[model samples]
Target: MPRVSPAHMEARRRQILEGAARCFARDGFHATSMQDILRETGLSAGAVYRYFPGKDAMIVDLAHHVLREVAAVFRDASLAERPPLPDVILGDSLTRAADLLTFPPSLIVQVWAETVRSPELATVLRTGLNNLVGHWRVLVEAYQRNGWMRPDVPAEHVARTLAACAQGYLLQSALVDRQDVSVVVEGLRGIMSIDAPTTQGT
Candidate 1:
């Protein structure tokens, strides 16, 4: 018997994960069984199980994959030579967030539900959020130091506020059918705008 190459193994894993994502998105995670994934992937039960032992493990891997994609976006933006405008930063963030919607909104709902039942998954999400927000906080502080952003707001507050805004955008879009991304970008710009102080005397 010929052994599968590493690339082939990774491809098989991706196939299984993709199929599981569709299953979870269409049916609630609780309702999506291994059989559903098998049908979706056109793979045997053994093949699917070879990639993931159970639904919970598959969901965990999917959540980690999604979060890593988001984290990569933040990491790239944070490494820019100069801080980008708030609107620019948020626009890029929202674009990355949109990737989460590649499947039905129900997929996000399922992930959130699982987080409640699984402390480990919840911690994974929390850590990802912290990493994103911390990167933003550093960028915000740098912008403030360079007089590119409002000094009146605390960097940590700004970071959390922007993170909340991004999450709110995601939640609203998932809960609703439509979203005006421009509105969100503009709102973030407003929040991070630099203030010009008036001279008391000339």
Candidate 2:
């Protein structure tokens, strides 16, 4: 047999993942089976199993991949010479995430729901959340240093709040109301425009 190159192996793995993502997005995780992935990928059962032992592994890997890509977006923004405001950074990050993921953003809702029953998935998600929060903290600290944000508040607290806002936006967009990401950024900009004094003068 001819030896396969690393690039070819990676490509094959991605093919399986992409197929799996489509199935999971179209049908919930529980409803998607290995046969469904095989049919979607047009690959043999042996080939698919060679890359992933089971659906659980595939879902976990896909979740990790999505979170890592999303974190990288925030990390890059935080390292920029002139980082964007919290709202802009989040909007950009979310936009990047939606574009990068092979599946629809709505699929994240299903993954999040599955976390309740899968401890491994929950742990992976928590770690990913922490990674994202770390990057957000850097941006928050920068804003505080520049006097754009109140210094009295803890940076971690602010970071988590911003992270929560982003998650809420995702949930709302996916479930409650579908709107452009610009709408979210614009709303945040509006809220930040009213600069109230940290302490009222006597």
Candidate 3:
């Protein structure tokens, strides 16, 4: 048998993951079987199994992969000499995530739903959330240093809030109405523009 190059192996792995993502996105994770993935990829059962042992492994791997890619977008933006504002950073990150994922962004809704039944998936999601939040914290601190954000507010709090905003956007996009990235970004900017009224001791 001819030996396969590392690049070829990586390509094969990606092919399997992409096919799996499509199935998961179209049907819920529980509904997508190994046979479905094999059929989608047009690869033999042996070939698909060579990369992922089962659907659970594929789900966890896919979640991690998507999260890392999304986090990278924020990481790169945060490291810029003149980092953009929170809204711009978020809009860009979400946009990049939507573009990069082989499946619909709404697919995340199904993954989150599955976490209730799968501890492994839940753990992977928590880790991924932490990783993404860490990058958001960096971005928040950068904003404060640049005087774009109030220094009095805790960076950690702001970071989590930003994460929540992104989550809410995804949930709404999936469950409610599909809105453009700009709409959410504009809302963030509007909220940021408001000046809180001073509260005297009462």
Candidate 4:
């Protein structure tokens, strides 16, 4: 094949992004330097910059990419053929939540902390947070429509509270043991009158 022109550069950017995601997830947003991405992806400095203007851009891409990937996984299952109310919340949170927490829980914590330091990162974080919760919250609203939930409790409130609790647990788990997530997840479940949530497969 002839040498691809710079027009194809965006594809290469995504390639480096994969390496960034791996490094960020394995290490952290701050720890994974541009050099780490270069060595991991075997791309030159100029080439990396051509794709992402700076490290902040790379971090933004990583945050958006991972959140969208997880959201797709949860949204599909949660919106699929299922029961109502409680099942929606469990389906949305359990499988992917456990995986995210068990592995790259730091990703959320890092971005949440970064909001204080970086305005751009904070903007990206807010948008990503809204996207994930908004996507999952649809399922809950559907359940409410079918009379599966109490009318007094709004689906948006449930979604936001759950999002807040889960995000907090990810951050707090760093100071305490990861096992402590049980308390948070259980507490959230109690509010919905459902059994505790688990990342484990059914």
In candidate 3, which residue ranges exceed 4 Å CA deviation?
A: 199-202
User: Model 1 segments beyond 4 Å from truth?
Assistant: 190-202
Candidate 2: which stretches are off by over 4 Å? 197-202
RMSD of 4: 7.3
Q: For model 3, how many clashes?
A: 0
For residues 130-149, could you state the per-residue lDDT of candidate 1 as single tens digits? 98899889888888888876
Candidates 1 and 2: which is better by TM-score?
2
Winner by lDDT between candidate 4 and candidate 1: 1
Of 1 and 3, the candidate ahead on TM-score is: 3
Candidates sorted on TM-score, descending: 2, 3, 1, 4
Clashes of each: 0, 0, 0, 0
Instruction: For residues 161-182, write the lDDT of model 4, one tens digit per residue.
Output: 7677656666776555664445
The alpha-carbon root-mean-square deviation between model 1 and the true structure, to one decimal in Å, is 3.3
Q: Each candidate: what lDDT?
A: 0.81, 0.87, 0.88, 0.68
Residue pairs with colliding backbones in model 2 are none
Per-residue lDDT tens digits of candidate 2, residues 7-62?
A: 99999999999999899989879999899999999999999999999998988998
Clashing pairs in 3: none
